[model samples]
Target: TGYGDDHTREIMRQELRERLIQAEREGRPLRVYCGYDPRTTDLHLGHTITMHKLRQFQEFGHHVIFLIGSFTSLIGDPDDVKAREILTPEKVAENAQTYKEQAFKILDPKKTEVRHNSEWLAELGFLDVIKLAQHFTVQQFLAREGFSNRLEDGNPIYLHEFFYPLMQGYDPIGLKADAQVGGQDQLFNLMAGRQLMQKLGVQPQVVIAMGESLPGTDGIEKMSKSKGNHIALLSEPGQMYTSLMKLPDFAMPLYFKLLLGWSQEDVDDMMVRINRGEVEPQEVKAGMALDITTIFHGREAALQGREFSRKAMQEGGIPDDIAEHVILSDTPLVDLLVVTGLCKSKGDAKRQIQGGGVRRDSDKVTDFDEIVRVTDLPTVLQY
Candidate 1:
C-alpha cells in the first residue's frame, strides 16, 4: 500500500519473485519479518492487517519473525506529529507479554519466530550509535511529513526520536532478514533497514512490502486506540460483533476486502446489489460481522453474538443469558456504571447520562448524580 503507485508495486512484486527464485536455488526458505511496538496491551483490528500478510508468507513456507520492539517503544515511533510519552520498562514488558498471544489468532505459532529487538538494540553503545547516525543526513529526517509538521509548528522534536529509524533499521541486520512487511506508514523505517543493510555489508537484498492502512469505525481516520475507534482482537464475541455491526455503510466494502479477503470485484458486486435494492445493506453487514467475529472467536461464539445483537436491536431487549451484576443500595449512579463495567470511567458514565444514552430498565437516566437506594434494588440497568 505504501508503494504509492502501480509502478512501485510492480517493482516490489518483481523483486519479491526474483528473491524467491534465488532462495529456492540456494535451498533455503526466505526470511520475512514485521515489527510491532507493544505500546498498548491489546492489539486492534488495524494491527492484524500486517499479521494476515505474514500468515500468507507462512503458508508459502517462508520463515516469519514476529519482531517485538521492546527497546524502541521506549522512545515510541516518531510517526505521530508530536513526541510520544516514554514508557517504563515494566509497562513495556507487561504489554509485550500479551502481543504474541493475541497475534497467534492470525499468525501460525509453529511457523512464526517470536523475537525481541532488545536482544541487539540494548547492546548498542555510544560509539556504535554515532557510527549508525553518520549514515543518514538531518535533511532526510526533516523531509518526513511527521517531523516536518512538528518542525513547521515549532514543536520540539527530541533527539531520541531520530534514533527510532536507526534502531528499527538495525533490526533486519540483527536477524539477517530477506524481506520485511509493514503498513504504508512504516515505509521510511523499512527503507532505512534496506539502506543500513547495504551500508553495513550485510545482504542489501531486502524486499520491503507495505500493506494499506485500515480505517477505523469512523470510516475515515486510521483505526487507533487513543481515538476510541478500534476493535480489539481480544474483545468478547458479542462486543466485537456489535462493534463491527456499527461500522458506517461506506466502511463495509473495505472490511470485506481486507479482513474477509474478498476480491475487489466481489465487493463492487455486493455494493451494486445494495444500490439496486436487490439486497439489504444490514443483512450484508451482519454477515460480514459474523464472518469476521468467527475468525477470532470461532463460529459458535459468533453465532451466539449475532443472536445476542439481534435480540438487543430488533427486540429492544438484552439476551436472557446476559451477565448479571449485583450492586449495593445507596451507590451513586455514576459510580455504579463504572463498577458494573457499563462505562469505562465515572466521567464516561456521567457523559452517557447527559447524552440520554443511559437507562434504568425502560426509564431513561436523566441525572448523572442520581442515587440507587434500597427501593431501586432488583431494577434492570441498561446503557
Candidate 2:
C-alpha cells in the first residue's frame, strides 16, 4: 500500500519517520485510525484535516480504520462544545451514508476499512459500560477541557456526556489501533484512549494530533454548518471554490498548508513571499481554491473554477453555474443586490458604496443615495 511515486515516497518517508519513533518500538507498520461523529449533515473543510492524517497513514502502509461514531453520536460527543444535542439513530445512519462517499474524494477507499462504532457500542450491556467506565475517574472526566469549561461557566453537564470518551476509548481497544488521529481540540479524548487501553491491558494507541481547525468564511469560530460560516463538502464545486475565495488573505496560506497538503517548506516560502508583498494575497487564495477544488473535483473543474472566478470578478457578476437569482422585474440595483443574498444587510449594501467596496457593471459606485432606476438597465445588477 505504501508503494507510490517519488513524491508519495517522500511524504510517506517523512510521516513514517516521525510516527515510527512514537510507535510500539517494533519494526511492523502500526495501525492508525480516526473517528468522526455524524453530527452535521455534511462534512466541511474542518473534517478533512483528520481525513488527511488518515490518508497519510494509508500512504505509509499502516492499517487505517475510518471509524463512524454512530453510537457515540447518539449520545453526542461533547468534547469541545458546551452542550450535547441528541441525534436519532436513523438520522445518524442516514448522514453516515454520505460521509464515506465525501471522504472517498480525498481518501483511498481501497486502503480504508470503514467501521461503525454502533456495531459494538450498541451491543454493550450495563456491565460492559461499567467495565469501560472503571478505567477513568469522575475527577479525570471533569478535568477535560470541554467539561471543565462548561462546569466553570455554570453550563449543564449531563451524565451521558461522560460516556463519550469511554466509548471513544473503547474504539482503539476494539480495533487494536496502534495510533489514534484527532484534531488538537480532541487531544483530551485521544489521550483518554491511551489511558483506557493501558488499563484494559491492551497496547496503548499512539496519538497523532491534527492542527487547529480552519475557521469559516466569517473567520471567527471553527467552520461549522450551524454557524452559517461553513463551506459544505457537498456544495457545488463553484460554490465551494467561491467560498475559499472569500477567506481573508491571512487565512489563505494556512488553508494551503493544512487543507491542501502543501509541504511545510512550500508553506514557509509562500509566507516569505507574502511578507515581502511579492505575491498578492488573492493569488495565494486562488492557488488554495484550485488545490482544494482539484481534490474534490479534478484538474478540469479546478481550471473551470479559475476561469469562472476570472469572469465573475471582471464582470462584477456571479459565476454562471452558481445559483442565479432571476429578478422577476428589473428591480432597484441596491434591492436587487440584497435580494440576491450577496449583501448581509441594506446598511451593508449602502456601506459598500460609501466604502468603495461596491461596483456597478465594472464601474465603482460612488453614490449610495442614488436610486437605481430599473428603466436605466433592463437587466439586474449583481455584486
Tens-place lDDT per residue, model 1, 61-154, is: 9999999999888888885567889898889999988799889999999999999999999999999999999988898888888888889988
Candidate 1: residue 156 lDDT (0-100)? 91
Enumerate residue pairs that collide in model 1.
Answer: none
Please provide TM-scores, in order, for all candidate models, with all chains considered together.
0.83, 0.75
Error in Å for residue 203 of model 2: 1.0
Superposing all C-alpha atoms, what RMSD in Å does each candidate have to the true structure?
Answer: 6.9, 10.1
Error of 2 at 214 (Å): 2.4
- Model 2: lDDT of residue 247: 84
